[model samples]
Target: MPRGGIGRHGLRPPPRRFRCVTAGRDYRDVARTQWWRAAAGAWLLGMTLEYIRYRIAEPDRAEFEAACARAAVPLASAPQCRAYELSHCEEEPGSYILRIDWTSTEDHLKGFRASDAFHAFVAEVRPYVRDIEEMRHYAPTRVAGAGAGAAEDTAPNLYEWAGGAEAWERLTEAFYREVHRDDLLEPLFRHMDAHHPHYVALWLAEVFGGPEHYTEERGGFQRMADRHLGKGITEQQRRRWISLLMDAADEVGLPADPEFRSAFTGYIEWGTRLAVANSRPGAGAAGWAPVPKWGWGVAPPRRS
Candidate 1:
């Protein structure tokens, strides 16, 4: 009987009649084979799968296989092609299957297939065009793997962990409430507006990875630095600012994890120091820059 052909009973004939092309062994046909069906059902829930099945003549088998490897290079580099593999059938030496996992059918069909790399891939395999017996895309009904249930690749940034804009609002409100009563810091903010806390929250939110509201709605870093020019901020005032903010962070439940607190306090120290320096008379204005993005135990590098 021909390989992979059905028997008189409507079942795949015994594998003994067929030779494994790659391994050069007799094939062993199994009953009720449902591997591909199960795989299709289990692995296609949220992803698209492209299946390409083809055959190569005896004399062209090796060259065709090499061409397939070369052809896959372009697909492998495409962001839409999440994963791919090529395998030769054990029971049919000339038979090959190419499986590519794509982010979406549109991503593969529209994005990758239209790209220059697709042309390159086609060129590599053009010689074996007649060997392609079947080629199509399939969507899996289910997917299971180590990373199948994983969340997004990016973790929440510092702003998210710090309870977002609302948390910063609470922190600023609490801190400024005390600032109004304090002998040392009150003088600097005596004329503060009723919405001072809101502005500060916007500034903090931008620095902590939340939004660009400070830059868009307000004047951003240059304006912030300009605020303190000629105020002659003292070291004692800087230290008090840090102390009060840390106290406010604690009172407002702003993520007391060691890593978080360390980053939070580090920024407070650095920012207050800069505030003090900028507050001095004759200090040059720092150029405009994006608000720093703080992370767990790290700060965005300062621009040159």
Candidate 2:
């Protein structure tokens, strides 16, 4: 008389299919039907996958592969380059593909190319430049992967999931309000401007994949970093600042889902730590760094 077919010793019985009388089908049948529907939907709204195809000559394939291995060093080190994979085609002997997963197209075009790493990367691959058949990025129209369930998430970027620029403005406004009340954090921002919250919103918006208004209107990352150059923020203050902001995120009705919160909190942790480092006296960190474009569960790699 074990409940739900559980054995006396606590061993579970085999899964039994219960029939749905209304639909005249078993539970497994319904599950399989739902799963296929989900798979189809996911295939319609695909992930962003970038591809770089190369067609090397038969004799030069070895040299090309060696060059690619060397070039990967600098590209792999780039903050924007998330995944760099070079593969040789099995059917076509000399055909190879160099695939890169970038945070975004702008991160590759504007950020990486502007860095010295690009110069080094280019030098290594220069010999086989002529052999490259196609070099382009692609955004998938549809994709399916493991754990894709009935609810096909279209995968909104952090900014969109956080409700875009207006949402960030609300978050920062509420956060600053809390900061003003917090005894530990208030002293650091004693002279903080009324517009500080709005500026912060723009920065968050840019970082979370909204728009580049912060960089276009303001001085971008350099200006933001320079502001913290000598504030001497303490560990206690940094922790309090992060805590207050997270509280504000909850208060303002931001997404409470694990994926969103993880990304959101991850950025706050990184940004606050950097703030603390930059606030220390005589820190020589780069002021002209590219504003990071954060995604679902990924933050940009810290530059050296």
TM-scores of the models, in the order given: 0.48, 0.54
* Candidate 2 backbone collisions, by pair: 43-142, 46-141, 46-142
Per-residue lDDT over 144-208 for candidate 1, one digit per residue giving the tens place of the 0 to 100 score: 22223222224565688788888999999999988988899999999888888998899888876
TM-score of 1: 0.48
- Among these predicted structures, which one has the highest lDDT? 2
> To one decimal, what is the Cα RMSD in angstroms of model 2 from the true structure?
17.8
Give the winner by TM-score. 2
- Evaluate residue 30 in candidate 2 and report its C-alpha lDDT on the 0 to 100 scale: 38
Q: Which stretches of candidate 1 lie over 4 Å from their true place?
A: 1-153, 298-304
Worst 10 residues of 2 by lDDT: 2-11
